[model samples]
Target: MTNPPSLLLVLSTCLHLLQWILDKLRITRLAQRILLHVLAAGPIPQHVAIVMDGNRRYARGKGKMVQEGHGDGYMALRRVLEICLRLNIQCVSVYAFAIDNFKRSPDEVDALMHLAENKLLELCSHGNLLQEYGVRLNVVGRLSLFPENVQVAVRKAEQLTKSNNRSILNVCMPYSSRDEMTTAVEGCIREALAEDDYFTESITEDTINSHLMSVQRGSPPVDILIRTSGVKRLSDFMLWQCCENTQLHFSKTYWPDFGLFDFVPIILEWQRSVWFRRHDVLFRS
Candidate 1:
């Protein structure tokens, strides 16, 4: 029902808005460069786990639709991924969707699935930033439960980046710590039964680690776990991997509002911890 002139105007407005956003994002590039230089002086985390929460709440607070908030959250994720890639983080794991998240309203869940599929397809295409960075894509979870189209998209993404070896991006879609652990345990039992001495000789923590979805896909043990929207609990994400050695970070800011500034402090804390440990050892020796 729209006329040609009006449509052109709308398109122009959108283009201008997008350009403005791009400019604003670049405004932080210089700062990011300086920050990365500072970070290079210390050890960077090999594996960083993020529990992205509060999209619906962000939408409610801003009078926007839930899906809009999620879209913004996706944008935030892209920025964080860029930072991780720039910092040369070995493994970046994000909890995009949990198995229990299926309990959300059907409309919201459908929206999320569609959004995820579209974003994934876009990211998998050649010449994207992820491709440029040589970041391998691993969607780690119970993927069989997804819709056929979504599964296809996920497969395409994984196939597209399977050759990338520089860094890893683990999208924990519809994953559950409990389910992962149970599956690993079951697999171990099966293997033990198949091989008489396997249970007695081979089954150990490392064996179980080899069976976990993310760990098997190539992510290392989580060095830092962050939950946004001020959440303090692990919320069933990476429970086995986020052990005593892992630093836990809970930010008061909403996920969509979290940015480079918010994340830098957490990394700094981890770096400080590393330095302190090294200094204490040297002093004792």
Candidate 2:
């Protein structure tokens, strides 16, 4: 005959069960508001980045088409953005499409382009959700590669959201850190060469930083980066920006399955880290 589960075991089981429920049905808005109040009492990161991965895996796991997974991933972005707006996060960057994504099958790439165009246009319809939230949108990447019609939508979204000042959302499309860095370096070189008396001292870290895509997009350095789908790597993402003073959170849940409950706990952990760091508490202990 076995005894009843220990208190710790029972508590752990309950927490796990709660997480299962939260994954399916998110905690009510009132609970989210309480979490936000707690977050507001602590030091909040100025900038956040997310490497949204595993959309296709999520779709496959749910017995849906890969494109449907991407569609759901976009919906997840909307949810996260709403949370960010409520939290007053200053800047948020998301990996929308990487440069390497062009290597996907022609049909898939075309589908993505269509989806992007539709979404951008949708943002302009109705009362303009982004405008109402005062969230500025910046689409950063190699823009010339996009088809003409898609480019029109991109410009429209940026224009529509330009008047907002409350927060910034940067969507990186067909982007690669290597390409961004190379472009910045090239820009610096061209400027230095253009000036007859250019000195090596003038090309400082600040100058190069000013030329970075993030800077041009008006995003500060990343304070915290969260990657979903349980992946650990940055995958040629904002490498230089994330190199220093960035807290990395890797979630086991796929991007589509990830929700606010999964996010707030990670951020609470970040808040704790920030508190300890400010107090000079050695992490080793």
Q: How many clashes does each candidate structure show, in the order listed?
A: 0, 0
lDDT of 1 by residue, 1-285 (tens): 985446545644644454444446644678677667756555899999999988889999999999999999998999888887777789999999999989999999999999989999888787997899999999988999899989999999999999999999999988989999988978888888887765466788888888898888888889999999987888889999986889999999899998877777677667767765665576688
lDDT tens digits by residue: candidate 2, 1-285: 432235335544544564465567656789877767756666778888999999999999999998999999988988888777777789999999998999999988998999999998776565866777888888888988898988999998988888788888888987998999889988998999999647888788888889998788788898999999988999888888885779999999899877788787666666656655644544344
lDDT of 1 at 141: 88
RMSD in angstroms between candidate 1 and the native structure over all alpha carbons:
13.7
Q: List the residue pairs that clash in candidate 1.
A: none
Where is model 2 more than 4 Å wrong at Cα? 1-26, 281-285
TM-score of each: 0.88, 0.87
